[model samples]
Target: MSEDVFAALEESQQQSPESVLERLIETLTAQKNYHRLFDALLMQQKHAMGLEVLQPTTFDNVPDERKKEFEEAYIEAARKVGNLFLDEKMYSDAWLYFQTIQEPERVSEALSKINPRTVPEDKVEGLIQVCAYEGANPEKGFEIMLQSNGICNTITVFDQMNAQLKPESRKKIAQLLVDQLYTDLVQSLQYHVQQKMPIAPPADNLRELIAGRDWMFEGGSYHIDVSHLNSVVRFARLLSEDDPHLAKVIELCEYGSRLDQQFQYPGESPFEDFYPAHLHFFKALVGEENDRNLAIGYFEKKLEMEPDEDDKQMIAYVLIDLLTRLKMNERAIELAETYLSQFEDPNTFSFTSLCRQTNHLDVLQKVARGKGDLVTFAGALLDAQNKPQPQES
Candidate 1:
């Protein structure tokens, strides 16, 4: 069997790590064992500089002192190889080597020393790979690329990395990209509002960004941030004020509402779990358009979506009132009867006024009679008989 060269050397003398590394260099060179020779060179360099060389030992099995010693040794060895690479003007190689060090600040240092342009086009991926290693921030590495290469070059390199990265690494890259996009969106919207510029362009830009990737909805945490969503709602409202007919406002509200829907809160409470911004937007939209059908349609859709009992009741009332005003008495009475039937005490909903306005006395009397509350039914019948019908205009 081939002997383990470094292990044998360690038993022969109590040489400092550096001296042992120097001896290994001499022996590996004499043997011309290039494969093991390169490994020895990197290992010895780490040893000589007191950098940790990662070994396959279990941390639980190792004593604290030994763990500390190995860590220190690993860092030293890594520094030696990195410095050696630097001296040879191999900045890219040096950066890749230093990335193996567990510390982030040192990796950043190695990245700083690299000349971005000198990195061969083929090596761009390798550079990005090292940067995306666990502790290193991918954005900081991209910044280095930006400085060395232009934005066009940096983006091209980023696309390549994104296509061939690990899932975790890809997620990190995605997060950094989304964060920059969010910042730009907020800044652009703010500028548009401050200068009182036409909001359509910024609003369109925001919609595009939101649709650009799903990661934007993450909002830098586990759940979506309501504040971030509210900002978009506020921007849409502002745009609506400037151009009441702006179709983009409706689109923004829809998109924001969809985003808000994906968030889950801990409780069953409607106020805590659901967002009301979209409702407000829809209400404002209905008022501006003054289209009776649109108002009716919006309220009906909202009534379908509202899960809470109280919210449903409120939306149903609005819908029934709007229907009465439009003189769609049959439809209004139908909706009122459907909703009022859900309760034991049907009179509690108090549909008498709605019946009187819409001339839905017969339907109300039927409902009142079903509950064995004939007194209320009798009054509705009497009112219907006494009231004068409308005259044709």
Candidate 2:
């Protein structure tokens, strides 16, 4: 809101998206309206500059009494906007807005306010065609589109189906919809568990794997490794895109930007770990950049709120991640030790204190010492520490 913040945003824009977005968001706090402001700015940014900002429409920003009004406005705007696009259709195009919206309120309005009979014949035909799209797989389409990792275009296809069905085909289409749902679910779940890039090890038996991890290893890990946290975060975010499924996305950000980086590079510079795999997701959800302080606060909130052990570890890692990025080794070491104390798993993530936390070299005293699962990290730290203090040449 201030000219100084505006200048800061302008300056940051040249450097990186996250920076500019973050600084600009600080100004938005002054605006009384939340979702509307985001929608308006994002609409302008996307249309004017071709920047795709996913404007969040969460109810948290709206006042209690005004929530219903905001909801109506949002749905009405979305429908109107969607219809505006449909108006450009030369022929029949189904009014597919009803199907794409999953919010109970929007769904009810769409059902009550819009009628299939009122839609154009060609539009009805288009709806049927979209329903039949191989991707939509009509039978399973609606559920898939609503799931955590559900796709949007697929939902649109289903909406189109809903928009154009005749009384005769309605029952048939409904049955087909039920049948394909199971099929699509199977496929989507498989896709959710599989990875291709630098592809992860086969999730040969994910059900068993996730289930087998006792209290210490279950929950937060989701059976993923430290290296894959970013990819998971990115994919999770793209799947949910901030609509309550947002929590998972944020978790990934905390893990990668704060936690995993801490474990991988003990006592290292923290700035190196700022690119939470889901920056794009955050950009889309909040439409504002969170500063270091705010980001740190989010991490703290995560740690406090998370009840699961693995998730808690992930949160701990995030603290380290932030510390490492900020080049706060002493703080990072303290946090890391605290984290290690929680789960005593030397094989997975173990690091000795690098600073002068104590004058004695006893930090590595707990090293597992090469009885098979002893990590090589102990050796690396030992060698680095034992190297005699340098003498003037």
The candidate maximizing TM-score is: 1
Candidates in order, TM-scores: namely 0.31, 0.24
Ten contiguous residues minimizing lDDT sum, candidate 1: 264-273
Q: Write the residue-wise lDDT of candidate 1 on 4-116 in tens digits.
A: 76566785458565667677767866674433445676565444445564442223434566677656654665566666665654545556556667434655565656665
Candidate 2: tens digits of C-alpha lDDT, residues 1-393: 457866887799899766675555455534533334445544433433333455544455445776565566556645543444334432112134434443223322233333444555444444334434422223322333333223344334444555344333333333333333333433433454453222534443323222322432323422234433332332332232224544434433443443333443321122233444244325435444354556666666666777776667777775764555455566666666655433443333445433233322343444334324345446546765786887999
Q: Once model 1 is optimally superposed onto the true structure by TM-score, how far is the C-alpha of residue 212 displaced, in angstroms?
A: 6.6
| CA RMSD, predictions in order | 21.7, 25.5
State in Å the error of residue 234, model 1: 14
Prediction 2 global C-alpha lDDT: 0.43
Q: Which regions of candidate 1 are displaced past 4 Å?
A: 1-188, 191-252, 258-328, 341-349
